[model samples]
Target chain A: MVPIAYYLVLSAVLFSIGVAAFLIKRNIITVFMSIELMLNAVNLAFIAFSRQWSQTTGHLQVNGQIFVFFVMVVAAAEAAVGLAIIIAVFRARNTLNVDQIDLMKL
Target chain B: MHLALFIIFAGLCVAGALNLLLQRHPINSALSLIVVMSSLAVLYLLLGAEFLAAAQVIVYSGAIMVLFTFVIMLLNAGKEERTHGSRLAYIAGFPGAAALLGLLTYIFLSHSATFGQARLGEYLATTDDISRVLFRDLLLPFEVTSVLILIAILGAVALARKEH
Candidate 1:
């Protein structure tokens, strides 16, 4: 059995990488993916804690696992809509570069 | 046995995530993110969340990432032009991120012993187990998600339509 701390630490590192990607990436899709990565990392932590808590209580718990399901569902919906929007943006602006698409800027 | 698997998969997961960041092209980054998700699924298996591991593979890496890749191909999103936007961002951002990672690691390591090792075959939430609560106690959210997906499809069609 691997220690729970290691899982948490791994989750944290993954989350930080996601953060760095989100901050550094100029492409909007990559930025969006970094957000997904961060969500996955959070899901890992939730499942790990859920397992730890479930074991301590001497029963199988379903809360954390279930939340991960909802997160996936939401991510799917977001991706569909977001990609559609990205297509629209590309059509209108002719570029996917975040810095180039500043039409909303004053 | 489990520890070794965890170490290998976890290392892959982190490396894939870093690669996702380092890649200049969005498609390359998307591919690397798939690597991260697959390794994460394995880690999820190690943690005994078999159902989520499968979902992570199917929904996340399979569906969402495919959508990302398709968009990249459709739009022909070129490699990002390297912008020397600000040296301050590098001097500031890298250290800030490192500090945040260090803080999180310190906190996790300090509290490492609070929880015990998660053993396999001990998790109670099987698919049936999850479905039971999902269909019973959490039926509303499930229904809501379906509706959300429906709305998302409609929204996508509307948004991606020609301006004619």
Candidate 2:
């Protein structure tokens, strides 16, 4: 039997991996991807929790899923804007190496 | 049946994330992320979050991934740039990753031992329930937040535009 705890644990592991990748990766695009991975991990936990609690209500109490929906929406908007910024940054500086973009230094 | 499908989707998601990490090209990584997103959507469906699943497909796989692909294509980021980081990162990264995983394992184990298994019933909280709360109770805030996000999006685009 697959316990909800198992799913939640997997989700947490995935989220931690994403966070590690996000922090360690220098590639701007990869960092963006790590963020997406983290979001997906959270979504998994949300769905798992929703299902685990859905047994008593006869209907599903899936507020977590709804929260995931909002998260996805925000993530989409964030991606669009984030990529646009990255694109612009790449134009000014020929490299997407995040460590090299020191434009703020006096 | 549900467990089987969940396992399959979960495996696919994990595989896709690993591939994204190992792939040499940014485009390949983006594609792998899409696979991960799609698998997550399937997992959402299996968990009976139908609306969420559809939204996941539409938002993440559709809009967000498309944006990522376009950006990757625009940058023309080659394997060389992708791998240009310091060797120091790998040395430090491995231990950091290990520590995070260990911490997570500890937390999960501790929580698992004590967490109560709460049982909700059918129609516990559906899309309609969310709609009722969102549209009826939180309508103004919802609209305001949307407008705020839209403005931020436009502002970001404008700021990102190259000056003549």
Candidate 3:
């Protein structure tokens, strides 16, 4: 009796939160987290739609799930490289505060 | 009820995201993000995307979150920022958050009228069917993902290398 719309709405709420956090947060780590939040929100919507259509046509609709798998793999790689970059930046700057990082202006 | 489960998962996801943003310590933030990822995997399972649920847990929580935790530990982040909370941030952050949530509610409510409802059981195909479609139809993206992963690995190494 679960409705796909419920899942979609939940995903939308998450996505909006991510967007707001990404735009407003000052800490670099917080911003990175917001990006991950957005990606997860998208994955939720994918799975919801996949389920909805599968039950309608009765043909094993796993494409959305497959896409989710790929997204997760890519997200892992991204987090690794992104954290490395953040580490390097912290090493050079001595601060993770976003406002203080203005080195490109020179 | 299924609605209750949806509410629980949604609450968990939002709570985790909020903790990630509000926690002063990078390590705590990293842990909260992992919680978010795990809850998302649970939601995926409920949605009948078992493969996605497994991948979500393995990749996001197991691998990516560990990397984030390691980086935070390595950097010793949030060691000096003793003062974490701010009254000014509460004023600005909460209003913006509330506005966004309101917008989402409006969108979903309006869209619900036009959105097509499909029966979920009709789409149940075997894993072989999924595998076949993925390999045959999505071959290009699959190969591209491999290349992307390789590049990410190389980039991480380059970033970690000591300067000569």
- Using alpha carbons, what is the TM-score of model 1? 0.95
> Which candidate's TM-score is highest?
1
TM-score of chain A of 1: 0.95
TM-score leaderboard ranking: 1, 2, 3
- lDDT by residue (tens digit), candidate 1, B1-164: 88888888898998899899899999999999999999999888887788888999999999999999999998888999876544666788878878988998998888877877877667746789889999999999999999999999999999999897
Question: In each prediction, how many residue pairs overlap at the backbone (N, C-alpha, C within less than 3 A)?
Answer: 0, 21, 17
Model 2 has a DockQ score of: 0.48
Give a tens-digit lDDT track for model 2, residues B5-90.
Answer: 76788888888888887776778888988998898877666655667777888888887888788777878787734444556667
Query: Model 1, A39-99: lDDT tens per residue?
Result: 9999999998888888788888888899889988998999899999989998898888887
Model 2 chain B weakest 10-residue run by lDDT: B115-124
In candidate 1, the second chain superimposes onto the true chain B with a TM-score of 0.91
Quantify all predictions' global Cα lDDT against the true fold.
Answer: 0.88, 0.74, 0.75
Cα lDDT of candidate 2 equals 0.74
Question: Which sections of candidate 3 miss by over 4 Å?
Answer: A55-58, B79-101, B113-127
Question: Candidate 1 lDDT (Cα, whole model)?
Answer: 0.88
- Cα lDDT, model 3, residue A55: 61
Winner of 1 and 3 under TM-score: 1
